[model samples]
Target: MNTDFQHGAMGPRPPDEDAIMVLLVDDQLMIGEALRRILASQPSIGFHYCSDPNTALKVAAEVRPTVILQDLVMPGVNGLDLVRQYRQSPATRDIPVIVLSTKEEAAVKSEAFAVGANDYLVKLPDRLELIARVRYHSRAYLNQLQRDEAYAALRESQRHLMAANLELQRLTKVDGLTGLSNRRYFDEYLAAEWARAAREGSPIAVMMIDVDEFKRYNDHYGHLAGDEVLKTVAEAIQAHCRQSSDLAARFGGEEFVMVLADATPGRTEELGTGLCRSIERLRVPHLASRVAGHVTISVGGALAVPEADTSPIRLVDAADKALYQSKAAGRNRATMMPEGVA
Candidate 1:
């Protein structure tokens, strides 16, 4: 709703002045006919008439007139009162009203002005003045409407632009192969989480996961089949790490990494063991895997409270060293470093 409309011709031109709308509320059919004929020469002006004094307000809402002309005295209602009603209505409040009276009494003119009348003229006004007044009021209303419409369109465009940017950001951080976080995003997110843990005195954890006998699987099953296994294993890892701040990413071929924020060494061990079990449940056959008849993962994890002296790389090295031990002791298992190790 907050919009700054540039009042320039460069903004927008309302559907040509060829469709100006004017409404007349009077109980006289003969007078309506006379006024219609007078305005007919100007095809740009669309004139409508309501002969029923009681139903004039309803017809005005339907017509959405830019300018209204009301007879000062109707059969039962005073035209000044109708002008006040139009001014009070949210829909018709901005419309210009002109009072037309057969008897031009000075007091009546003053009363009409007090009741929201924009202009006062005698019945059957001068042709030049009627056209000029109608055109002026019509142009004023249409200009404002056009400006509002343009600002609305601009706001919609800006909303679409913002959504598109967010989508692009999401796509850039996603890994195309496994629909997991890409390495670039994983590295940045881990660094950020590490810094946050340091400031908050919370423990940050890392898990280095590697597929057992992956190269043998690729060699025996072909690269495409190996790709499918990689995808399945990546999904298994992602499913096990449920924390919103935890990140799972394919570190490289046959290797994946997870960064867990606000996690303890004990919690890290539990999650790493769960990841091994989840992959085992997949039951994907791997004839070349020496550790098992099916595909499996070896996980090495470390957790530490970040200090001003200790760096993120040191914690990563500890996790990497533990992963080396898991692979050496035989794959398809989880290994955790000693807790409180700097």
Candidate 2:
């Protein structure tokens, strides 16, 4: 074997900003070292030399070499075998492999290409041709690398934007003070529920609750204390609305609303009465009210099977009328709306 390798010539010069990594695999230690020194002298090429095909594969994975320079005749694993191995491994499959060999036969060249060799170069080729081949492949590899990085970055940004949009939607519909759905969300939900109830011929119930003597309590205890009372009362109401279809909301100052899906008139009244009793039991000391010794709530309930002719506002108004009746008849009591009205 004529292994009289040319060792002195420097490889292709690398770009100052970005250099292409190249892997040189050969069984002869002198041949591998010569190739490494030649390529290392080039400013634009980053060369990794391996005497074993397995070690070359390992280095290819770690460095992601842009170009592979393989020697065909080796003792253990030949250059053609190494090319097959590189092509089989997903990590190294796309790397371009050029076979450097002493055998210049056309049959040897054909076998090299059959095993996935990208280019075939005879040993001791002209230095200028070697440099040109390396430079062309390096530029192509750099282009692909840039494109892949840009695509990855774009996908990451899209994911972040989607997450931020979802967070914004959550904040918009959620009440800051009580962590329940706000009035805006409640209105939208009521409309949808009304439509569903009409289609299913199921009863939908509305409950309007007013904190007894809330205005007087705010005046006597200050707004901060009133806020605390409101939060506590909101929690109490939410506790009573345990079902997935039940919705509780703060319907403006000292007043709250609940929607009970598929509830009967009697069931609505029972739930409303229970909620009123729970608030009364809270006994948040409010000495200013004549109706009760402590803080309490009056509830007005209405239940109806929704129809195409019925609107969400009608249900609210009916509940409001019943609530007014409760306040007038005497505070701290629950009243049910008349059947025809709701």
Output the number of the lDDT-best candidate. 1
Candidate 2 overall Cα lDDT vs. reference? 0.81
lDDT of each: 0.83, 0.81
Worst 10 residues of 2 by lDDT: 1-10
Query: What are the runs in model 1 whose C-alpha is more than 4 Å off?
Result: 1-151
lDDT score, residue 295, model 2?
Answer: 93
Which residue pairs show backbone clashes in model 1? Answer: none
Listed in order, each prediction's TM-score against the native is: 0.57, 0.56
lDDT for each residue of candidate 1 in 212-273, tens digit (9 for 90 to 100): 99999999999999999989998888887787888899888889999989897678999989
Highest-scoring model, TM-score: 1
